[model samples]
Target: MPTYSRFLKEILSGKRDCDVKKMINLTENCSAIILNQMPPKLKDRGSFSIPCAIKTLEIGNALCDLGASVSLMPYSVFTKLEIGDLVPTNITLQLADRSVKYPIGKVEDVPLRVGKFIIPVDFVVLDIDEDAHVPIILGRSFFATAGAIIDVKQGVITLKVGNDSLTFDLTNTMHYPSSPSENCFFVDSLDPLVHDMHEHLLISNDPLDLAILNREGLGNLGVEVAKYKEQ
Candidate 1:
């Protein structure tokens, strides 16, 4: 097993802001971040990092996604397992598409380069559904520790962590959109005045009536509310 001491910094496009504190916690504990259809809610506060594959379009190359997710495992962990030691195990993985159960295991010790950072991670290779054509799926543990921002929009996944950001267009990637009805409409533009007022009222001392705003979608309104509080 080899220890990764170098830290990589890269910028990616089409990223949505994430709570920095939450990200730190995820890295510290080696937890995976799941992007799903339901409204955001925190769970699995503390747990052992699992080795799994990460599938996304913005990843560009197959190696990028593999390196992003499994690097969290310390060098000691890698040494404990051999190529055959890791076997196919059932695990649930979350992606922008659909959540599915897959078999994955720590296959080999591989070095991943993210800008200036070089990390050695235990590669968890697995065969996704028959429809999956990508090489592997990177787990959340590796991604969180990479200190990058992951963005999903218009079927694209982008990762920007550190000073460099990379975008992966999923036009040809293995994607499983949960359902057509699950799609949410995004507002292209909003009046600054209305936006400011809406934000102010939502963050005011009194409870807000978020339901009143029908013009803007609830997701946009909710994000605005969260931004107000975050500020």
Candidate 2:
């Protein structure tokens, strides 16, 4: 029978008590179940047990990698942070869904908790958003640094270092977003012509033409003058 037909029949027939072992075999045999277990569709939501303490640091209100030669956050997020201020330490971290390995680094003045052992780490903090029930974020910076992968479905967070990947299943926990902030892009000028020119120059490979047109003081008046001459 077709899988959808079986699903529909089950739905119409209502719940029935089934043998546990047989149900397990049936579930294992289901093609849809097998496909859903693939990485992309696997919605392993919620927190898993972590073997090590997650650390945090605030590097001058900017997210910086702990060591030199590390990848830096984009200017958009970096500019908002203050320098030299001891940012919050010791926040919980949720891991990524995929199981790839990467590098790790240390930071200072960060909150670190591992199992029942909480320690302080001098490390840059990573910003991860867990707003949805199945949070899909584990900052690329930290992931690149620490080389970790989080399998929510399996309830494990794996850390890879030097060709070996370590897995940890954190104690089940609830994760939530910190706060909602209104993100706005403020423009100083409301002039349509200025806006159009700005966009054109920004996307244009040869911005020099726009620069020459602007510097020469040839605004729309030049266009009018040319039209009159042509007439």
Candidate 3:
């Protein structure tokens, strides 16, 4: 009989023939991994957006993305809206294509009316060509401020303020234009290089900021970014 160490060394060295078992006991997690019993993969659900307005200007489709650290607005849109004076900022943004972009300026506390809730949003103004379909990117910062609850599986997003809450169904809300010129814009990544100004401008303490919706502007609230109606 070989010693325990010698027996193990022989087995490892293939000097001794070891019996192979057809079945082996495994932990639940291991079994799941080996049997490929993980959650089913889902297709790209496209982007999630909401109808938002800044004062009088109605932004038909504002892309709500979790990938971005800060909200983004185009210079063209900035020029059109009289939300606030563009405050100069040193914060840098890196886009999806790994291209670096310097924002034109920053706008603070712009009242964004979504559904019946009025939430204050800070936007980083960029010089990119405004996508007629989706003009803005509402990043994680806005989500944090708005107390947003996203259900990717069901394609539902609920925004809460204090005790009040509003929900939107993406299936009905996402309408694309039939025009050939309509372009799609997406923010896959964002790298905000923090500076002195960036450090001071943190997420607002009052996340649940809310205001009553004006009945006079109800007509503009229904405007969709795209031209076509989706069934």
Could you give the C-alpha RMSD of every candidate to the true structure, in order shown?
27.9, 16.9, 22.0
Q: Kindly list the per-residue Cα lDDT of model 3 for residues 109-151, writing each as its tens digit.
A: 9889998998998999999888887888898989988999999
Candidate 1: list runs displaced more than 4 Å. Answer: 1-109, 113-119, 125-132, 175-231
Which candidate number maximizes lDDT? 3
- Candidate 1: worst-modelled 10 consecutive residues by lDDT: 2-11
The total of clashing pairs for model 2 equals: 20
What ranking of all candidate models by lDDT puts the best one first?
Answer: 3, 1, 2
State the lDDT of candidate 1 residue by residue for 131-195, as single tens digits.
Answer: 12223334555566555444333334445565766554544443333356546778565688788
Q: Give stretches of model 2 more than 4 Å off.
A: 1-44, 47-138, 175-231
Alpha-carbon lDDT, every model? 0.43, 0.42, 0.80
Top candidate when judged by TM-score against the true structure: 3
Provide the TM-score for each candidate, comma-separated.
Answer: 0.27, 0.25, 0.62
